[model samples]
Target: MSNKQPESPDSAEIFERITYLSGKAQQMLLDFWTRQEAPAALTGDPFGMTSLWPAMTNAALSDPLRLAQMQFDYMQQAAGLWQGFLSGDVPEGAEGGAVRDKRFGSEAWASAPAFQFIKQAYLLTSRYIMESVGALEGLSPREQEKARFFTQQFVDALSPSNYALTNPDVLKATIDSGGENLLRGTEHLLDDLQRGRMKMTDESAFEVGVNVAATPGKVIFENRLFQLIQYAPATETAYEVPVLIFPPWINKFYILDLTPEKSFIRWCTQQGLTVYVVSWKNADETLADVELDHYVREGFLTAIDKAIENTAAPAVHVIGYCVAGTSLAAVLALMEERGDGAKVRSATFFTAQVDFEDAGDLKLFVEDSENASFYGELSEGRGYLDGRYMATTFNMLRANDLIWNYVVNNYLLGKDYFPFDLLFWNSDATNVPAKWHAAYLRDLYRDNLLAEPGGISIDGTAIDLSTVKTPTYIQAGKEDHIAPLRSVWKLTRHFAGPIRFTLAGSGHIAGVVNPPAVEKYQHWTLEGTLPETLAEFQDAATEHKGSWWPDWLNWITPLSGEQKPAPQPGEGKLDALEDAPGRYVKERIA
Candidate 1:
C-alpha cells in the first residue's frame, strides 16, 4: 500500500508445498510413516545416520528459508553436473553415451536446481568482488581488475580437497579437544563421497525409526502425567538390593536400555540387580510449574522412599547421568545431612559435576551478559526453555559436522535422505522449566554454590557434596565436553567415604556406553589408590586396552554381593513391591 512490492503469493505457496513434501519425505525415511531403513538403503551403513538425519531434515523441512536455501544449493550442484559433462569428465560420446548425452546435454540444464545454486554462489562472490574494488575506487583500473581476479582465485581455491590439507592441524585438534571424532567422522563421509567411493543419494529430510519398539509390560505406579512401566526380570529371580536409575529428562530412558546386546539396563538385570529407572515426564508449557525441587521431591526422593519402603533394605543405589547426575549428588548430600543415610547405600555418578570452577566452555553461556539476557527474556515468555532452541545450541557446538557438513551434502551433492537412530534421539528435545533452569545457571555456574558448603540452598537447606559419606564410584570421560573430567574428579575430594574414579576412552555418549568392543579404546590405570588430580591420575594410570565395561562389571560386582540366587518375588526385603523393575518404560511426554 505504501509503494512497497507486493508479497509473492506464489512464493508462499511454493514454500508451503516444500514444507509438506519435506515432512512427508522425512517421515518415510524415519519409518514414522512407513517401515524402511533409509540409511541402509542409501549409505549401506546401519549406523550412518546416528543423530544427524532428523536434525538436518527437520531444519530444512519446517523452515521456509532453510528449505529455500536447500533448493538454491541443489541448483548449484546441477551446474557442476553439467560442467562435468561439458568437460568430458562424464561420458556423453560413447556408444551408450547417447542416453546420457540426451539427459545431461539439454539446454534445460540451465534451469536445473543445481545450476541455480551455482548462479547464486557466483552472484554472492560478485557482490564481494564489487565491494572490495569499490573500497579501492581511487586505484588504477589495472589494480581494480587484479583485485577482482584475486577474489575469484580465492573462491576457486576453496575446494574440499585443498581445504582438507590446508587445515590439517586444526582438523586434528578436535581429536584432542573432545570434538575430534565428530569432525573427523564427517570428513571421512565427505571424503568417501568426493572420491566416488560412495554414490550420492537423494536426501530430502531426516529419517528415524524405532529399532526395538515393544509394549512396556504395564504401569504399576501411575501419576497424572507419568506411567511407570513394569519390567519382568530377564532371569529366574533378581537381587535383594534394589536400584533406581535416573536419566536426564531430555531423552528417553531407553537409551540406557537401547538394545539387548548394548543395553546397560539389560546387563544390570542379568547381574542380579533389581533395577527401576525414573523416566521423567517431559515438560511442556502447562508443566511449567514443575520446578527442579519438585523433581527432587515428588520425582526422585519419592521413588527412593518407595524403593526403601518396598524393599525394607537398609539402602539402595542411585545412578544418574549428566544433569540427572548433578541432581543425584544434591539429593545424596541433602539426605546425608538430615541423618537419612539409611536410604542410600552407595551412589554412582556418570560424568556428573558438583564443582563449577573447571566447568569448561559451557560456562560461557551463563557468563555472557548479552546471551543470558536474551535467554532470560525468552524464558519469561515461554515459562520454560524452548526445546528446539536448546537443541539448536547443542547442534551449534559441533557446527562443522552438524551444521556445515549437512550444508555441503544437501546443497552441494544434492544427496537423498537417510534414517538414523542417534540423530532421532538427538532431535527428540524436551523443554526445561524456566524457574529450575534460571536457578541452575545462577546457583551452579554463576555462584559455584553446589561445591561450597552453604552456597546453594533448597528451601533453606544447603547442598554440600562434602557432607555426603556414601561410598561412591564416579566415572568420567577423558574427552567429555559437557562435564569436564576434572570437575567430575573433584567429587572424590568432597566425599569422605571410599571412592573409585575411572576414566573412559571416548567422548560423552560413547564413553558412558563403552561396550568394550570399541576399536583400540583405553582407560586410565588403577594402582593402590585413585590419584588426587585428573592430570596426575591420567599420567600415572595405565591405559587399559579394551572397553571399560568389563572393568565396570568387576568393580561393581564386589560392591554387590556374590552371585547368590536372588529371592523369588515377595520373599526378600523387596517382598512388599509389586514387581521387579516396575513402571519405568520409555515414552515421549506429550
Candidate 2:
C-alpha cells in the first residue's frame, strides 16, 4: 500500500459506484452450530453465479458487436487515463466526472496519477458490466432481475474503497495509526464473530425503553404471539375511533418510535389519535407450530378487539406495515367473510404487498416452488426462522449502503461511528415461527396466491381481498426494494374500496416513518383515477413537499369520527400489564 495520504479535492465527487459486497462466507459457516437450538431458516444460496454466467455467455455469443464496442470504449477511457497520468495535466472531471462519488471521493483518487487511472478504469468496467447485463438477451424476467442484482453485488463488492491498497483513506489511516487501526479493526471483526452479529451502531449508546422506544405507554394485553401497548394520550381530546398499528414482525416496533423527534407513534398521539401498537413476541421452539391462521386469529383479531374494547368505540382504524400489512389484508378479508368487517372502520397499509407478481429481490429467496420443501427444511428443526438470516438478506438488497459502508468505515478505516437509532433498531432482530414463515413464503411469496380470490384460507375461511370493501389508504415508497412500488400498487386492483394511494420519497422505513416536522422526504399522490401502471401513477401523481404524514391525517381524520376526551392506557377491559416498549421487544437471539 502507498504511504501517501489522500489530498483534498475541490469538491468530493459522489460516484455512481456503490461500495459493498459478499457476506462473509466464513461467518455463515461458523454460526451453524453456535446458532443455538433455534430453527434452520433459509438464508440463501450464495447468489447463483449460474444465472449470471449464462447471461455473460449469451452476450458474448449473441452480440459480438456490443462486446467489441464495450471493450473499445473501455480501452479509449483507459488510454485517456494513461495519457493524463503521463502528462501530469489530468482533467479533474474527465468524461464529466463532476458527480460526487464517495467510493473515490478522496483527492488522492483524483490527483494521484496511479489512483486516477485505477478509478476511471474501474468506473468504465463497471459501466460496461452493467450495460451488458441490462442488454443481455434470452432470460426470463425473474432470471434477468437476478442476474442484474447479483452482478451489482459483485461489482459493488469490488469497489476500490474496500481495500487498503486501493482506498487512499484506508491506506492513510493504516499509516497514520502505525497499523493500529488494522489491529482495532481485527478486534472488532473478532468481537462480531463472537457475538454472531455485525455491530453497526454503538449498542451501549441507546437502550430500548430509556431512549429509543421511550414513548409513554403501557402493555395492556399479552398473548403467545404479541403484546398490545396503548400509548398515553398526547392530547386532551381524541378521535372516537382508536388507531391500532401492526408493525412488521420482521423487526421490532421501535422503528415507529425511534426518538421523541422521530417517533411516528408520538406524532400520532399529538394529533389527538389514540395509538395502540402490537409488539410481536420473538418466536422460539415453543411457538414453532404457529401458522398464518394462528397469527390472523390470535395476533391481528385480538389486537383489533383489544384496541376497540379499551376505547369502547364501535370500530378501530387499523394500520399495518410491511408483512404485517400483507397479513392484515387477509384478516380484513376474513372479517368481511365473517360479517365482522365493521370492526375495522378503515385500513392503512405501509409498503405492504398482497400480489407477489413482482415481489422484488426478496422473492429470490423462494424462487422455485419445486424447492418449496427446501424452505420447510430450513425451519424444520428449530420451528422458527432466525431474524439474523432475514436481516442479512435485507442488508444484501442494498449491500452498498447497509453492509459495505460499515465494512469500509469500521473494518477498513477503524472509525467509530455515532449512534444511529435506525441502525440500532435494524440490528435488533426477531425470530419468526417456522411454520408461519414457510406458509408465508409458499403462499404469498412463492405461489402469489394472496391476490387471488379464495387463494389463501385461514382456518377454513377464504380471504378474498375483493370482499374487503373497507376504505383504505396505501403508501408505497418509490425506492422500496423489499416491497417495490409496482407490487404495492397492484393492491389497487384487489381491494374493493376507495383507495387513496400515495407514493413516498424514500425507501420502506424512512418513507413511512417520515414525520411532518422534520420535512425530509417528499411524497406523491394522484387526485383522479388510479393508473394501471406505477409509471403512469408516478407521471400523473403530484409531488408534495416534506413528509406524507399530514396528507394521511387529512384523509383519515374525516373517517376517525368526532373528538372526545382522550382515554389513557388501559382505561377499559384490559389492565396495564407493564410499562410501554414491553419485554417482548427486549428479547434477543441467543
Candidate 3:
C-alpha cells in the first residue's frame, strides 16, 4: 500500500506536466498552421499562379487527408511511447514524453469541423468582397487572358521540380556535390523537396553589373581589354615582343580586371608587360551561330595579327585561364602543326587542364551517347545550346546549398536575401552555343583527345598540348574540385616549357579572385622543386603564407621590361584611346 501511494503522486505529477506541455505544443502547431494559411501575393489567373498552388490547393481541399495522416502518426508514436514507458526509458513526471506522443494529434485538431467551417467562411467572404469591388472597375477579356498567362508562367516557374532543375546537373554530380554527410537519407521525398527550394533561391538573385561598378584601372584601346596592342618601348620605340591575354569565356574577363585590390590586370599593366585580355561578348540567342573556332580565329588570332601589324613584334605572349587556357593550348598546338609559330613567343596556362581523364564526376553528361541525344533534342530550333539549360546543370552540383537552403530560407522561413558576392556572380549566367557545348561535352569532357598528339583536331589541325613550348606558369589550386590538383598538374608534364608551377588557396572562384587582404592563404611548391605528379609533389611540398598573387607578381615582373612611370594604358607609346574602365558598364543583365 505504501509503495502504491508513492506511485500515485508520481502519476499525478506526470499528468500535470503532460497537460502543460501538450497545451504549449498545441499553440506552436496553431501558429504554424495560421502562418501557412495566411494570404500570399498571387494572381487568380489560371496560368500565372505560383507553381505551389497545385500542392497548396490539393492540401487545402483534402483537410481530412492531413487529419488522417496526423492521427495515424500519433497512433504509431503512442505505441512507441507506451513501449518506452514500459522499458522505463521515459522518466516519470517528464513533460517530453507526453509532448512527443501528442504532436501529431495537435495537428489533427486543425481538421475538426468547427475549425474547417471558420476557415472556409473567411476565404469565401474575402473572395466575395474582392469580386464585388472588382466588378465596378471591370477588365477586358484580352486583358484577363494576358493576366492568366502571366499567372500561369509564374506558377510554372515556381514548381518544386522546376526550381530544383533551374540550374541542373547530372544526378551523380549532384550527389557528389552534396558531399558524404548529406548523401545519406537522400532517398526521402521531403529531402528532395527541400533541396529544390534551396537551389532556386540561391541561383535566382545574381547580378554581375553591381560588381563592375567598383572596378579600377584606366581603360585602353577603344575601351576593350582584348584589343590589339602594338607594344612600344619607353624610348617611344615599338618593342620586339607583343602580348595578348586569352581570357576563358567560362567566366567574365573582369575576374582578371576586378577591383584594384584584387585586380590581376592592373598588376600586369603596372609591371610594364604589354597586356590584352579577351572580353567575350555575353552570348544570347542572337550570337548562337558562333562556334569554338570563331573565338580562336576572330578572337586570339585576329588580335595577334593586329598586334603584329601594329608593332611588327615577331612573337606574342598568349595567356589563358581555365577553359581559355585549354583553348590557348589548342591554338598553340594548331599553330605548331601548321608551322605558324612565328607570331607566337611564349604561352602561359592558368589552372587549365588539357587532359580530361581525371575530370571527376562532372563528366556524366559528357559521354558521347549523351551528347548526341542531348544536342539532337536541344539544338533543333536554335543553332546554339540554351544558356538557361547550361546554368541549370551547374546548379545541381550543390543542390542542398544552392537549392534546398534557398527553399528553406526563402519560402519556408519567409526570409529571402543574400549579400554575398560569390553567390551573386554565380547567379549571373551566360549562354553557350549549341554546337560549342556539344563539342565541348563530347570532345573534351567525354573523349580524352586534346592531350594526345593527334587525338582531336581543330579545322583539320590536331591539338597536342605537348607541342606547346610556351614559357608557362601553370597555377593550380590545392582544394579545387572542378579542376583537381592531379589533373591540373598534368599540364606541367604535357607542356614543354620552362614551367613554373604554383599552388593557390581556396576553390575555383576564390583562388582566382584572391585579394591581398586575405593575407594568410597557404600554398604549396614541389617541395622546393617542381614535380611532374601532384601526388609526388604533395609528398615533397612545403607550405607558405600570404596571397599567391604577390609571389606570381614577383615571378612575372622580372620577365617584364623595366618599369618607368606607370605607362597610361592609352598614353604616348600605346594606342591613344579612351579613359580608364569603359564599355562593360553599359551592358547590363540582371
Candidate that would win on TM-score: 2
- The window of 10 residues in a row where model 1 has the poorest summed lDDT is 200-209
Model 2 — TM-score against the truth?
Answer: 0.89
Residue pairs with backbone atoms closer than 3 Å in model 2 (clashes): 13-100, 13-101, 14-100, 14-101, 15-100, 15-101, 39-382, 40-378
Q: Evaluate model 3: give its TM-score.
A: 0.60
User: lDDT of model 2 at residue 363?
Assistant: 82
lDDT values, one for every candidate: 0.57, 0.83, 0.53
Could you tell which candidate, 1 or 2, scores higher by TM-score?
Answer: 2
For model 3, give the 10-residue run with minimal summed lDDT. Answer: 179-188
* Models sorted by TM-score, best on top: 2, 1, 3
lDDT of 1 by residue, 1-590 (tens): 49988764464564465456445444443543253222211232222233333433443355566446645765565465467646635322211222332212333233444333333334444444344334443334433443444444444334231232222322333223333233333544544334322222321132211343121222345443343433445666555566777787655666676545556776676666766666666665666676667777777787787666654555678888888888788888888777887678778888888888887656645633423554555565656665555655555454444545554444333344465444545545666776677678777876788888877666458777778888787888888877888888888888877787889877677788756544446777566677677788878877877676676667665555434454333443333233323333333322
> Of 1 and 3, which scores higher on TM-score?
1
lDDT per residue as tens, model 3, 389-473:
5555555454444555454344333333655545544544544566677777777887777877888777766677777666677
lDDT of 2 by residue, 184-242 (tens): 66667767756757889888898999999999999999999999999999899999999
Using lDDT as the measure, name the better of candidate 1 and candidate 2.
2
Q: What is the lDDT of residue 505 in candidate 2?
A: 95
